[model samples]
Target chain A: MTDSGFKKLVLSHFWVAFGAFGVASVLGLYQVVERSGLIPALQSPKVYFASVSTHGVLMAYVLTTFFVMGFGYLVAVSSLKTPLWNPKLAWVGFGVSAFGTALAAIPLLTGRGSVLYTFYPPLQASALLYIGAALLVIGSWFWCVIMLVMYGQWKKGHPGETVPLPMFANTANAILWLWTSAGVALEVVFQLIPWSLGLMDTVDVGLARTLFAWTLHPIVYFWLIPAYIALYSFVPQAAGGKLFSHELGRVAFIMLLILSLPIGFHHLYMDPQQGKGFKLAHGVGTFLVALPTLITGFTISASLEKAGRQAGGTGLFGWIGTLPWRDPMVLAAILAFGMLIAGGFGGIVNASYAMNAMIHNTAWVPGHFHLIFAGTTVILYMAIAYYVWPSLTGRTLVSRTLPVIQLWTWFIGMTILTTPWHILGLLGQPRRISSVVYNSVLTLAWTPYELAMIVGGAILLGSALLFLYILWKSQTAGAPEANAEIRYAGYEEPETPVPVLLNDFKLWNRIILALMLVNFGYPIAQFFFTKTFGSIGWGY
Target chain B: MSNLIPVHPLEKRWIYVVLGVIALFLGAIFYTALVHQVHPPGAIETIDSATLHLGGEFAEDKLGVRTDADGHLRATLVAARYGFYPREIRVPEGLPITFRIASADVLHGMHVPMTNLDTMVVPGYVSTVTTTFPKPGEYPMLCNEYCGMGHDHMWSKVIVVSRESWKAAAPQTGR
Candidate 1:
């Protein structure tokens, strides 16, 4: 009850995050409808591309960065049972990020920054957008430093004690992010900002893409680890059971941080910039990262099963029926896992060295990511928000039924949307097109799928609005909840001693440094050694 | 501090299953890449995208299917803002045709649907991929990556004709 300052801090960050989400959802609906070519009045390539760019920036950059920062703060304070490392500094980071978002919106809304979120050069957007994006990332670095410092402080104070699992996972994400954002940050500061500002005449597109690929794959992991944190830290306790194995959770976090960094070349599988050996090497790493997710899946499922059985469930499958589906966190986890299974399958195809050609840059790419990032990751974000709203706001939820409905609708809507998207990819439909103006037989096959996506988008838009409404109502009008204290899942068995290696990141960081040097050192250095011709900026 | 907890027995077995699944995938990928010579396009050839059309291999006159010195067919193409150069090209079916494509402006991705011939034509790099078209048909080759405003219209055709007819029509160019 005395943590009002922390509550205010968390709520401020979440508001910015969800505000971006709300606007992006509206843009997403427009994009699906317009791209369907159903409404003649809505068909404009300029607007469509601009909307797509804005939507991507909002969801991928704004929403994820803010949400993770806010959530990390919450985990740091609540799990460590300590005051925020630097409250004023945290507010400054939020201010810088919010200001950057507003600055970027200037160009994005005016159709000047239509270069999609990838912003692959030599296609250029307004320099303001790049600078804004750079600022946004810089601000997140502040959050990262804060998280790491708090983590180090906690460990120093409680020598040889296992860092609380939530803080452990949260700190791992902070390290992962600092590593992940470095690639794009270098590209932005060194290449994009100068090139877009006309300070540099030409930029090496290959290097740009290589750097982006470095960031692209791991950024997903960055967004995902917090969701994983929610699953590991909250789901079991919320389900009225204990964590199945705390050690496995720590191992999963460690694996994610190490394996996710050097595997980005899988995104460049079909690009001509890198070599086959490097691509194959990165592809292997991509597959290695999946192991942790599989571990997590097993661990979380077992935990849920234990919870279900404890609630008087019997037999093999009966435990599933006994699970408290009405609990928002439990429902979200189940839905998220289901989506992860489907999305992970698509990802495997993408990471396959030769198999990537079948669907690279096709609609399938978006389909897979939407299923993973938006479907699985964001759904869990929603669940975490719902579970913590009472503690954060010191009020009861306005409507529990609305949140349950919202989660189901999100899952259903995502399934409806991405199913056709995958079908279209198989049909050879390229992604990022404004309209189906090809009028060919292959494109004709995509019409029904496009139509299906519009319906999906509308449903998702409704769900997003409902989510924001629920949060708004809970914050403003809901009755007070006096006993709202955050609780994390506990281990089923008595605590076992944790190894120094698992508890600390020093060895892992060193391993990551070596792996990154091996994976990227030559590939990136090759660009400088070769007689590369940089290309001048071209506007959309 | 105590020692690290041993992984649960059931979880250890599950971990093995996970590793097996990953190994199976890696096996398939390695086999296709090594034995079948099937791999993603990773041609590290660079060109000045700004002046690509002025002369040399991607010059307008040199853009299309042609017989190389090795007697293998190679298609040289250029992807610009709105369309692929040559708009349409005829290649014989059931023959391995290597495509060496580059972007004259911005970045683009080329994919012939239902085939494994897909590569991103980065502005300053040549994207090369080789594949055989078994069935004769007019396949639409579309730009999978967004280039600019005219991106939706950025598509061409790959007309795969019967080998005999293609040879008869252009015997001098045909192997």
Candidate 2:
């Protein structure tokens, strides 16, 4: 396929992804206002829940999956300097995923699949929802196969050479997704689908949860790796700096692949079926995963510092101010870092075995996730969209100032949104409630925070709409023959003679499989090994 | 394919510092659990939810303060659709109270709003969390998990009174 052909393919994928994101953003704002109990007409539990469920599925599943697939295609073609191995298969995947999204969205919008995007059964939804979800996952698996095949083709053609960093990370994520998604896939195939279809009278909810837990946490990394790829590959170059260490970047990717897969039991820490021993094991592994993030933070900061120094900065932190913040990519990185610091601290507390008592299932959990997902991950997605729009559409962004303002507004809005969410959680306000107008002293204390969240949600909604406008404007605006090309950050040093394992995922994939066996082997097997009761589906 | 610049010394040094901090955080988390006796909720416990209310420890009348053979106060509570069984649990202040809770139907999280005691009560197993109330006061306990439509109304009370008052309130044989 020609470059324009490739661009058209990826652009179509992103348009679908961002379209879902736009609808979800509006639904999210409606939820915040409804939950605040500030408006009477908007406060229906049925409507609120349907909106929440749709918003969650659209943002969490549709947006992230489609964006990653589209971005992966771009990365594979650009980094490998070749067309997609099978462009036809890619379009098929996109069509299947988009159709599946529509199938699931029907139930969610109609209040039929109001199980809150979590298949924590007995609270079951329509069979179509499960089948639709399964199809979405299955569609993405096609992307995985394509990514691996293209990666393999590249390595075979160019023997004894380093895989480009962006392609390597992209492939690692593909491998991670393949492994990480299996748990949920197994759950859907065995339990949820059968139960939802009424083929099974009762389903083992414990097994369902255990399997879902396997997919739940690592999937965050699935959403996050693209952001990390942009950080490592794009941000440094955008800032006029080289990566501090290419070797460290590879190590971080490896660590994420290995550690992110097996430590999902942290999500099940408070779960009763699992033993304390397993939870502690997963908790330790969860903490270990933090190391790679810390490494990323350090490496990225050092890279930025190097950039600032080259631009005549002095002193310890003064280099921060000297770096080019005008560039949308650079500004997004700085903003993402700020949110990461705050969100990472929340995550540490959530991961702490003892400290989890303070915040588990509270509003704090959502607060932390939104900051990480929306604040950190989506900001980078926004930046990447901006960075590549010119190449994809052969059109210049309508206004340079719009993107910078939108980024700042997103950052500001997220801070306003999550800060009080953390406080409300600490104040013992439970999450997943449609309204909090109980008229108690404790409920009264939550009112101010609820109002604050409404303000934040409004700002976020406005920012999201503005973002879509910019992207739309960019596509429709007149072409500029700027001939913008994909530019990845280069390493400061020639990488040390690296082993073949570091270059490719073949050995690493096997190692991850082994680690999963160790981490979850008995935990999952014990369910079948022992006598476990089944619970019938309850909610519609 | 071209030769890049050499690795920066300071960047290498900072990587070590970040790694070290991560190690320290891990150690600190484990130390509290292993040494300080600050255990995670449901440290290790399970119960059959099918028979939860029919018979066994969490049966209706047996849902309040029950003293073990060794004189440790154990509170057995069951969380269900819209409420916690034994809507009121009386515990003596200034002593460690062990709360063993289970979910009868779906997933329910138990949390004492004012205390450092919170845990999810999942069906098929019991969750045990141990903590002490330093002062005598009534602390509201609520279900943190979204069990169903009635999840918002799932609230209970943990009434912590003086030792003599708790003893007086308890049924003599049950204790």
Candidate 3:
């Protein structure tokens, strides 16, 4: 394929992804300020919920899906040294998803689907929104197939050689997504769509929630694996060091793929429908998922430490100071690591079945998730964009200094914003409140934190605008020569041949299938077998 | 092959250390849950959500604080769109009270923020949490779940009072 052809494929998807992010950022600012009720003019529950729902769907589903798809293409082409298999089908997927996004946006923007992103049923939205969401999932399925086909083709050609780590993980994510989305896909098609279109009088809320739980938690890893891919395969090289261990990276991905699927029931711990035994089983699996994250943290940190040492740093901890702080990717990895530590702690707390009651459904949950999803994952996405954009667009960035500025403001702003959010959750403030305008003493205690959040929101908004501006300038710039080459971090290959299980996924896929049946089979089957009640749709 | 680098022994040691720390953390959480009696929210019983208001323990007239078969003080509450059934709940202070909560509609979560009392009130199943409020006070119980358009206004309070005051007021039955 021509360079221009590949660039077009990558850039088209990225534009949609970033476009959604740009809109969501503005809506997020609106929510923080409106929730504060600091400005009476902005205080409206109807609008707040609408904006929140749109913001969530855009950020969680639209942005992550498109970005992952686009980035997966770049990884496939670069790592596999192959042209995109079935490019026409890839375009078809993009078109379908984009159309779906547009269809979903209509009801969301018009306040006709203020059900928030969870869309927990009995609270219904317009049929268009449900159909749009289903279409988006279907479109992503096309990307998954294309990815797997390319992966299989590369493996066929390479034979005994190990697949490139980036492509390996990318393909793993594609597989994970295909499995992860099946639960929600089943729910939307069989349960939500029919109920929303008014063809069904009543919908089973327990079954709907049970199915959603199957998808909910693993989908996070789908969004995250790209960020992790960048960390393992890109950041070490960007930081002027080798990957600490390539073997560890493969292990982490494999563990994540296997463990991420069965563990989603932890999200339903607070819910009534699932039994204690099932929740406990899922909780155990949830704790296991944290293992891979911890390993990633250690491996990446060790890689950076090696980089710092290579730069002539001495002493046990002095290596940290010697590493590159100016490189946007390196800086993002460092900052993202800091946020991940805090986020990981919060996750451990959330996964602890008993302690979850203290923070579940509170503002603390959002605080914890934002730190993970927005803080750690999204920052890495920015870093990946920064690294890849120049190569993809064939132009030098307009301003080098602006990216450093953007990363800092985002980190600082998130800290300022989420710190008070965690506190408010502890102080008895609920998560989805439209306003904290209550004049009571309990509500008044949240005033200072509310004010702090507004300031943080403003800073974050400015940072987001700066990010968009930087991307725009880079894309539009005219450079002397195109810089289309990508440099991934290198690590020492094992002197002995790497194990087949680490290299190929056939056995692992079989294992995952069995595990899924064992872990999820009974829980999902019981829903259909049991005497369950279906509730009628109420909300619009 | 040219770019490949070998893993250092020290890095391997660090990996072990990291894994050890993770193991310790998980072990601690399990210990607290199993040995320390820190239990999560859920009951063994299942109820038909559509007929919640019709019959059995969660029926409309049978909601709120009552004595269970085991002679334990049990409180039953229904979570639905816009409000919690028996919106006002009164429980005696300084007693181990088991709250049996369920949702009549979609997924709703009950969180009284100041206390270790938050659980999802989903349909078709009952979530139970046993706890004691040592201090006598009015704890505002907020529906933290995003139920619907009226979610913001879905606020209720649980009045925790002394046993003497509780007897004087009497446990009001039925919604």
How high is the DockQ of candidate 2?
0.48
Error of 2 at B10 (Å): 2.4
- Tens-digit lDDT track of model 1 for A1-540: 256777898999999999999999999999999999899998999999999999999999999999999999998888888889889999999889988898899999999888988887888999989989999999999999999999999989998798999999999999999999999999999999998888999999899999998899889999999899989989998888999999888999999999999999998999998999999999999999999999999999999999999999999899999999999999999999999999999988888888889999899989999999999999999999999899999899999799999999999999999999999998999988989887467777888999999989999999999999999999999999878877889998678668888899999999999999999999999988889999998888
Worst 10 residues of 1 chain A by lDDT: A1-10
Model 2, global lDDT: 0.85
What are the per-residue Cα lDDT tens digits for candidate 3 across A1-540? 246877898899998999999999999898888888778987788898999999999999999999999999999988887788888899999999999999999999999888888887888999889999999999999999999999999888878888888988999999999999999999999999999888998887878888998899999999999999999988999889898788778888999999999988888888776777778778888887887888788889888988899998899889988989999999999999999999888888788877888888888888889999999999999999998887888887777799999999999999998989888888888888887633335777888998898888888889988998999888997363464577678884443556777788889889889988977898888867877777888763
Looking at model 2 chain A, report the run of 10 residues with the lowest lDDT sum.
A435-444
Interface RMSD of 2: 2.7
TM-score of each: 0.99, 0.96, 0.95
Residue A247 deviation, candidate 1, in Å? 0.3
Look at candidate 3 and tell me the lDDT of residue B133. Answer: 80
lDDT head-to-head 1 vs 2, winner: 1
Clashing pairs in 3: A270-B120, A491-B5, A492-B4, A492-B5
Q: Candidate 1 — which residues are off by over 4 angstroms? A: B1-4, B172-175
Question: Model 3: residues >4 Å from true position, as ranges?
Answer: A437-440, A493-496, B1-12, B54-56, B68-70, B163-175
Give the Å error, residue A309, model 3: 1.5
Give per-residue CA lDDT, model 2, range A416-479, as digits (tens). 9999999989988888888763334567688899899988999999999999999998788746
CA displacement after TM-score superposition, residue B42 of candidate 3 (Å) = 2.3
lDDT of each: 0.92, 0.85, 0.85
